[model samples]
Target: MLVESLAVLTLALLVEAAIGYPGRVYTAIGHPVTWIGALIATLDRDLNRDDASPAVRRAMGVLALVAILAVPGALALALQAILSGFGLLGLLAAAILASSLLAQRSLHEHVAAVRDGLRAEGLAGGRRAVSMIVGRNPESLDEAGVSRAAIESLAENFSDGIVAPAFWMGLGGLPGGVLYKAANTADSMIGHRTPRHDAFGWAAARFDDMINLPASRLGAFLLIVAAALHPWASARAAWAAVRRDAGRHRSPNAGWPEAAMAGALGLRLAGPRTYGETIVNDAWMGDGRAAATAQDVDRALALYRTACALLIGLAALVAITALALSR
Candidate 1:
């Protein structure tokens, strides 16, 4: 089972990297993440009552998380069971489905768009492109700010959007990937400290942090390795920055990759930034240059691509080892 799971993970990464989820398919049938989001929205509407006590809302949030995971988990298991009977074809189908959970190609495209926007439309274009990937206030950002924000989003999402899902799928196959996506989607939808969500989103936020723990470290390690391979980047600096600054960032998991990318590229990230009217005074991730430009964004993207390639290589290695042991 472990061998099969790792094989599926390797193929899924390859598939997603080759071709991302298509826009036409998304328009026609919606996405797995969107479907999960819709369910979360409904649960929030029906169960997360404004008038309810905090304790009750917290309990309901837990219930909502369970419900959110159960639906997809069961379906993934059923689908896996059915596909297993089909032999190699079943594995391919499962890999295709699992590929949707990852964002390797999409992340690269989005980050590249930020650099393209800056070059083409100046700061305004960069802000517009960066806004799509980050939750921070783009209008408040200057050229350097836009560049840093794009790099930060790329680094953090490298863990959350790529590594985490792949890690889970490599362990538990379809069900693991689906469940991680469901939890991650839930966290993004409702995991805020707002008055309405602080209690209600408690479980989703905490669970996401917990499940992401291993991937966060692994992602930082991959970035470090990629840095070593890059001519201009420094693996030693990346590792040092992770050790020094990853623990200081506001988020438990985001800082790991952000710090590694920052050090690898010799740019600071995740410093104090504004989201709406709110200002988050977080510590800088690296003691490097803070004046990040579109060129810096390009460098970061290169490092990110290398890290992703490393992840695929690791999955392939694991799959091969598992297959050999099984035989």
Candidate 2:
């Protein structure tokens, strides 16, 4: 299972390396959340009706992952035997799914649109882009705030959209990768600290944390490795920033990629960002390079490119290792 998983992931990654994203990726925009919601619904169905504590929510979250791995993985394997296109199709699907998780081109373009909008139209145009990509309050944001929002999204998504799914696909297969995305979507939707969600979404949040644990660190390391490739960002500085700042964020995860990205991009990231009406004072990540301007956001976009290429290399390595083991 492990060997097969690696080869398939490698093949998918090679497609990304060789050709890049196909044109139809935008079709699934924000739609993974629907599949993710369905998984949470299944867990909610079996959740202990007796005690709806945080513990129970967490148990349900685990059960959701178990549910994800069990069903889709079996179907994919079974389909592989009878279907000639199964392997390639599965590989393609895995690649597309993995590509969907990344925001290199999309993040860059979207943030650039915001910057352009700010220059061309006004704050209202900036708000539109900020509202679309970030979970923060868009109306109150100025140019600096808009840049900050975009930068934060770039850093955090480096973990969620890219690292987490790729790690799972490398560890498992297409179904494994897709399932991880679903788990992430569930956490994003249900996992909240609010009274309405703290009980109901508790399970999703914890599971999200668990799944992202290793991937976040890997993402940080990969950022350094990726920076080393171009010297656009400092590899040693990324390591130092991650070691110094990753633990400061509220999440056990998230901060690794953010810190690495900040160091790599040579910008300060994650301080105070508004979540809806809430103004949370997040501790700073990175080496506190506060000279960040709108252009810094643009450079972070380039860092994302490096991270994407680095991920493809990692996938190829995983594939090669798998093939060697199979022989």
Candidate 3:
């Protein structure tokens, strides 16, 4: 199982990098997170009642979160067990299933679309492209605003989408990745502080925080290492920014990579921004220029690519080491 797990980690990352989650596969079965989101939505609608007390809602949230986490792991483990008997075919199947949890290719594509849009159509296009990846209000963004938003989303999601799942998969195989994706999906869908969700989503939000703690740090480390390889990036600056600014972010986990990216690329990120009509007066992540442009986004993408390559290389090394030890 150790060898199999390592093989799945290597193959899944490569497969995802090569093709992403195919549109046809998504069209046929929908995405795994979406499927998990549906279940969370059902629980939210059914159990999260207005009449329920705060204690009741919080307890219900925990129940829902537990079920969400358990179901996916059980299914994946059962599938893995059944497939293991098939040898190589089982490994391939596990890899395919695991690949669905990663977003390395999709993340790059989405960020690249923002760069392309800004280059081709200016502010409107950039805003439109950035809107797809962020919850912030797009209409208020100038060109710099759009670029920063796109880059910020890229950095933050790079942690959640790539590092977190990969970290879990490396340690716990397919079921670990599945469990992580489920927790992440739950956190996204219900983990909010609005009047409707604050009490009910407490468990999901806190649990997500706990799970993401280690990977978030690792994500920053990877970005710093990647920055060292790129002429335009600064590993020293990335580490400095992480120390200075990661704590400034609202999320317990997101600021690490975002700050590292900001410092590495020498661009200020996560300043004041609008979400719908509300303006969040957030502290800036890096002390660099606040006036980002499409070119900055492109540069960020280049840095992201290098970081991703570094991550894959690290995973391959780990897989190779595990294989050697297993012998």
Q: Candidate 2 — worst ten consecutive residues by lDDT sum?
A: 75-84
lDDT of 3 by residue, 187-234 (tens): 898998877789889999999999999989999999999899888889
lDDT tens per residue, model 2, 1-327: 677677666666555445545456535454444555665666666662545777766666567656654565566456544443676665565555555444455555676777666667776777787788888889777777787677778777777876787788778676667667767776776677765456666666788899999989987888788778765668787888898999999889889988887777766778887877899899888765655556777677777777777777777777787778778
Cα TM-score of candidate 1: 0.99
Query: What's model 2's lDDT at 234?
Result: 82
lDDT (Cα atoms) of all candidates against the true structure? 0.96, 0.71, 0.91
Which of 2 and 3 is ahead in lDDT? 3
lDDT of 2 at 42: 66
TM-scores for all candidates: the values are: 0.99, 0.82, 0.98
Model 1 ranges with Cα > 4 A deviation: none
Please state the error at residue 174 of candidate 3 in Å: 0.7
Whole-model lDDT, model 3: 0.91
In model 2, pairs of residues that clash are 57-203
In terms of TM-score, the best-performing candidate is 1
lDDT for position 154 in model 2:
74
Looking at model 1, report the run of 10 residues with the lowest lDDT sum. Answer: 262-271
Instruction: Predict model 2's lDDT versus the native.
Output: 0.71
- For each candidate, C-alpha RMSD in Å? 0.6, 3.7, 1.0
Candidate 2: stretches off by over 4 Å: 14-32, 38-105, 230-232
